[model samples]
Target chain A: MKSRIFVTLKNGVLDPQGKAIHHALEGLGFAGVSDVRAGRLIEIEHDENVSKADLEEMSRKLLANMVIENFEIESN
Target chain B: MRAAVIQFPGSNCDRDMAVALRDVMGADTSLVWHRESELSDGLDFIAIPGGFSYGDYLRSGAMAARSPVMQAVIAAAGRGVPVLGVCNGFQILTEAGLLPGALMRNAGIRFVCRKVRLKVENSQSIFTSHYDADEEITIPVAHHDGNFFADEATLDRIEGEGRVAFRYAEPVNGSARDIAGILNDAGNVLGMMPHPERMIEAMQGGSDGRRLFQGVMEGLIREIA
Candidate 1:
């Protein structure tokens, strides 16, 4: 099975890269732009024996930093 | 004093840390690779130096924190060994759960590399014992992600407990409350963004960083004696 993990900064945390991207978009004359936040996506392949709990544990242990980020696991 | 400088694959500052400790501070130092599961027994101090460990692949210090050698380092810290993490090392400490808070991307969205001023916060700790209360010093910081962040409650608790070891005298990286360095609850582990090892001598522009290693070595000698 293949799964994708999305890691994102938690609410109220500042996203500088996202902000810079937004500024660059405005400089390019893009209109009605809202705020932007940066995050990461990790794709992993595991045996079918792997369960959702295992993936969650993986996310908690390494894929996401619990202090500043949250992670969601999606199975493909 | 016997010290171990942890060296990750991309660690460029390990030699600087060893030189500062061995030559200036007069401690016998060794560079321990990240893959080793064992550190030298009876280590008085361990240092995590600055660099782009693991090429900063996932996050600064994230991959290195989970490497084998860190477990040994963590065990040593549990036994009250002094551990100092600078720059990327600071990020690894936080990632390894040895210190509180996460170092985020700089608020200005740029890689900061320059000498910045810092004020000693808790000099009573072993790490800052050589510094006077609220004394200002200059140290160099070079990182893209030195901005420190934690929740308000954790911030209040650590501040109330005097776990903060240093604060930026100026807003250099937009760190929360301008925090530059912090100590663990036991006060044996200190992680700071500034590179104290680099500033250990006058040729490096100033020698204010010398006292940090000096103080720790003295403290260890006293303990051993």
Candidate 2:
């Protein structure tokens, strides 16, 4: 089974990198961009025996820092 | 005093930390590698030095936090052993769940490297007992991801509990409450962005950082005695 995990900063947490990207876009004359939030995508290749709970555990334990980030797992 | 410096594969400050503890602080210190599952017994202190551990892969300090040696560190911390995490070590502690909050990228999106003024917020901690309360000191901070972030409730709780050990005297990083360093709930673990080990000697610009290690040594000696 293959899984994709999206990790992102939790709401109300400052996103400095995302803000920098937004500034760069404005400097390049791009308009109508309200905001940008940066995050990470982790792709995993796992055996069929790996259950969803295991994936969630992996995300919680290693892939995402629960302090300021949240993770969502998607299966394909 | 007997101390150990935990050295991850990419840790660049392990020697500096060892030197500060062994030579400056006059403690018998050893460098323990990350792969070592067991730490030497009877350790008075454990120093996790700053560096690009695991090349800052996944997230800053994420991979290094899960390394085998960290289990021993956590166990030791649970036993009330004093642990100091500096800069990247601070990040690792948070990732390892030894400390609260996460260090994010600098608000300016630049790697900040310079000596900045810090206020000793809680001199009562074993880590900051050498400094006077609210005393301003200069220390070097070098990190790209040193902006500390924690929820409002946690911030309130730590502050209410007087767990903040150090605060930035000026705007250096966009840390909440301008927190430069903080102690764990048990006050046995400290995670800070500033490098006190780097500022231990006068030749290194200032000796303000010396007191931190000395304070820990004295505190440990008192405990042992």
Candidate 3:
């Protein structure tokens, strides 16, 4: 089994990297780009016995800091 | 006072913290490795020093916070043992849930490294007793992720409870409310981005940082007495 965790800063949290990328895109003559928020994708390979609850625990404990970020898990 | 400095792999400031506690503050101090699940007994202070722990992988201080030694650290903190986390140590404390808020990337998108002025916010805590209230001091802050962030309610709560220990006198990083250091609700733990251990001696350009350790010693002595 495999899983993917998408970690992103919460909506109100300031994302400096995302802001810089947005600036660069605008400087490169791109139009209608309102905002950009950067995030991370973490891929994991695990045994089939790993339950969704276990994955959620992993995300809560380490994959995302609830203070400023949120994580979504997908499994296949 | 008896103290211990937790040393994670790549913790560059462990020696400096040990030196500050042992040589500068005249306390008996030891370096405890991260793999150890137990801490020595009768410790008055525990320091988590600054460094690229676990190479800042998966987020700064995330891995190190979950290290074996942290369980001991968390237990010690629960016992009201004084814990100080500097720079990456601050990140670790937040990740460990010992402190509120998280440190984010600098708003300027640059690594901030320099001596910056800080105002003592609340000098009544065990960590800030040596400094006068509202006193301005200069300390070196070197960090890529030093901007502190928290929900508005948390910010108001900490401020209302007088848990803010230090605030930047000038804009250095875009920290919320210019917070430079903060205390846990119990007032036994402190986490900050500045490296006070680096400014402990006059030869180190200033002795402002020495007062922090002195304050801790004073508080411990008061406890013993």
Candidate 4:
């Protein structure tokens, strides 16, 4: 199975890197960008026996810091 | 008194921490590597020093937090052993769930490296007993992801409980509530961005941080005496 996890800062958390990217875009003359947020994507290759529960546990235990971030797992 | 300074693979300040504890705090100290699953018995103090642990991979301190030695440290903390986490160590403690919240990028999105002024918020903790409450002190803070973040309710609770040990006297990082350091609910674990170990001597520009270590040593020694 292959799984993809998207880890992002929780809502209302400050995203400094994303804000910096927005600034760079504006400097390059881009417009209409109201807000920006940054996150991480992690892809995993695993055995077919890996279950959704396992993936979720992995995300909870290590992939995402639940205090300030959330993780969504998509596996097939 | 005896102390253990944990040394992760990328830890640069382990020796410095060891020296401060041994020389300044007058405790026998040893450097414990991250891979060691168990710490020797009779450790009076544990310190996680600052550095780019695990190369700051996955997230600052994420990988290092899950390493074998942290389990022992966590167990020790549960037993009321005093633990101090500085800079990258602070990040690791949060990642390991020994401390609350997470450290994010600085609001300015820059690696803040300089001596910063901090106000001692709680002079009652073993970590701060030597300092007067609200006393301002200068310490060196060198980190990229030192911006502390926690939800409003969590922030309120920590603040209300007086768990906040230190707060930035000036705008240095975009830390929520300007908290530079905090103690865990058990009051045994402390996570702070500023490097107290680096400022233990006059040549380090100031000895303000010396009192912090001094307090812990005195507090622990008193119990034994």
Candidate 5:
């Protein structure tokens, strides 16, 4: 079994990297760019017995910093 | 005062911090590696020295925060031991949940290295007791991700709670409200982007940073007495 975690800066958090990326897009002549917020994705491979709670705990412990980032988990 | 300096793989300033604490403050200091599961007992203070920990891989201090030794440091912090995080250490503290906010990329997207003026916002804390409030002091900051970020409410709360320890007098990085350093709610943990360890001596161009260690040492002596 494998689980994927998406880590994103919370709403209202400033992401300068994402903004720079947005500006780079504009500089390269790409128009209609809305906004950019940088984030991370982690894929975890676990055994079949691994539960959602375990993955959530993983995210809370190491994958996401609750002070600034929010994380969601999806198993497939 | 007994202090421990946590050393990560790429921690270049651990020795500098140790020398500052040992020579300037005369504190009994030890260097603790990241793999250690337990810190030496009865530690009065812990200094997370600045450097590109883990080569600043996957965000500054991100990998180091999960190292085994951090658990002991976090435990010591919860026990009310003073923990000071400078530069990359600041990022580790935030990553360890010891402090709020994140040190993002510099607004100019370049590594800034120079002496910058900082305002002593609150001199009452154990870390800044030797300085007067609103005093302008120069400290060196060298980092690529020293831009501090927090939401408005949290920023206001941090300011309201008197947790803003050091404020940059001028814009060095694009930190929110020019916050250069801050303390945790319990007042035991401090995370700041400026490198106080770099400015502890007159030969270092300024001695403004020496007072922080002196203040903390005095506070620890008083506590021990």
Candidate 6:
């Protein structure tokens, strides 16, 4: 079994890196760029017996800092 | 007072913290490696020093925060032990959930390294008791991901509870609300980007940081006495 965790900055939080990337794209003469936000995708391999609760626990404990980021888990 | 400094694989300031606690704070101190499970019994304080712990892999202090020794440190903190995390240590504290907020890349994406002026926001903490509230002190800050970030409500709660221990007197890093340092809800755990251990002596440019360690030592000594 495997799970993928998507960690992203919450809405209304300042994404400085994303902002820099947007600025760079504009500097390169690229148009139609409304916004850019950066985040991390972590893939984990776990046993089938692992429950969704367990994966959520992992996200809460380490993958995403609940203070500044939000995490979503997808398992297959 | 018995103090222990946790040394991760790449932690360069462990010795400096040990020296600050032992020599300046006059407390019996020991260096506990990242692999150690058990700290010395009856430890009064734990110092998590700066430097690139595990090369700051995954994120700043991410790998080091999961090391075996941190479990013991977290347990100790739950028992009311004073834990001070400086720079990389601050990142680890946040990663380990011992403190709130994440240290993002500097707002300008630069590694800021210099002496920064910080205002002691809360003089009543176990770590900041020696300083007057709002007093400005200069301390060296050397870090790449020292920009602190948290949601507005959490920030407000921390401020309302007086958990914000230090704030930058001037703009240094693009920290939210210019927060240079903060304490956990327990008030025993402090995570800050400034290197207080580096400023413990006049020969090191200033002794402004000496009072923090000394204050903790005195507070703990009084508690156990």
Please list the Cα RMSD from the true structure of every candidate, rounded to 1 decimal place.
Answer: 0.9, 0.8, 0.9, 0.8, 1.7, 1.9
Per-residue lDDT for B91-167 in model 2, tens only?
99999999989999999889999999999999998999999998999999999999999999999999999999999
Rank list by lDDT? 3, 4, 2, 1, 5, 6
What lDDT is reached at residue B162 by model 3? 100
lDDT of 1 by residue, A1-76 (tens): 8999999999999888999999999999999999988899999999989999999999999889999999998997
- Which residue pairs in model 3 clash with each other? none
Report lDDT per candidate. Answer: 0.93, 0.94, 0.95, 0.94, 0.91, 0.91
Stretches of model 3 off by over 4 angstroms after superposition: none
Which residue pairs collide, candidate 5? none
From the highest DockQ down, the ranking of the candidates is: 2, 4, 3, 1, 5, 6
Q: For residues B66-147, what per-residue lDDT tens digits would candidate 6 score against the true structure?
A: 8999999999999999999999999999998899889998898779999999999999988999999989999999988999
Two-chain DockQ for each candidate model:
0.89, 0.96, 0.93, 0.95, 0.57, 0.56
* Per-residue error (Å), model 5, residue B114: 1.2
Tens-digit per-residue lDDT, A12-57, candidate 3: 9999999999999999999999999999999999999999999999
Superposed model 6: Cα runs more than 4 Å off: A1-3, A45-53, A74-76
* Candidate 5 C-alpha lDDT tens digits along B1-225: 788999999999999999999987898888999999999788989999999999987779999999999999999999999999999999999998889888988988889999899999989999999999999999989999998988888999999999999999988889999999999999989898888888888888988899998899899989989
Candidate 1 global lDDT: 0.93
Over B1-225, each residue of candidate 4 has an lDDT whose tens digit, in order, gives 889999998999999999899988899899998999999779999999999998999999999999999999999999999999999999999999999999999999989999999999999999999999989999999999999999999999999999999999999989999999999998989999999998898988899999999999899988889
> Runs in model 5 with CA error above 4 Å?
none
Interface RMSD, one decimal, each candidate: 0.6, 0.5, 0.5, 0.5, 1.6, 1.5
C-alpha DockQ for predicted model 6 = 0.56
Across all candidates, what is each one's fraction of true contacts kept? 0.82, 1.00, 0.94, 1.00, 0.53, 0.47
Question: Mind giving the per-residue lDDT tens digits that candidate 2 earns over A1-76?
Answer: 7899999989999999999999999999999999999999999999999988999999899999989889998997
Q: After superposition, how far is residue B207 of candidate 1 from its true place, in Å?
A: 0.5
